[model samples]
Target: MYLDMPIDRATPHVVRESVDAVRRWEPRCEVVRVIPSITESRETIRVQWRLADGVIRETEVPR
Candidate 1:
């Protein structure tokens, strides 16, 4: 991760990394959201998505 990268550029990269991490490890779920913290000292990623069974799940990822 590049600390100098702008938020717009970094956001998608982080989201992609998040989706890839989940997809590669778990195929039973689909990612619907990947959000970065608006105000935090450290980067915090919040992920939300739906599973194959149509259940929605959400979790926070510390990057």
Candidate 2:
């Protein structure tokens, strides 16, 4: 739901908001970073997180 918002650019506010939402909803992992990449037709959010076992995983959400 959070990723569905319309954005003209990848601003700092947008990035910080995304990072906060990820941390709030998923408590099991620590968010390493939330990167917002914008292409011509879509926006992609790449989230890097560190699990409790020290494994780092990444997920890309395109909207």
- CA lDDT of every candidate: 0.80, 0.77
Q: Please give, for residues 1-63, the per-residue lDDT of candidate 2 as tens digits.
A: 344455664445667877888789988889998888877767777989998899889998876
Each candidate structure's TM-score, on Cα atoms with residue i matched to residue i, is 0.71, 0.72
Off by over 4 Å in 1: 3-9
**Residue-wise lDDT of candidate 1 within 1-63, one digit each (tens)?**
656886666777887888999999988879888888845546779989898788878999775
Q: What is the lDDT of residue 18 in candidate 1?
A: 89
Which 10-residue window in model 2 sums to the lowest lDDT? 1-10
In model 1, where is the ten-residue run with the lowest total lDDT? 35-44
RMSD over all Cα atoms, model 1: 2.2
lDDT value, residue 46 of candidate 1: 93
Report the number of the highest-lDDT candidate. 1
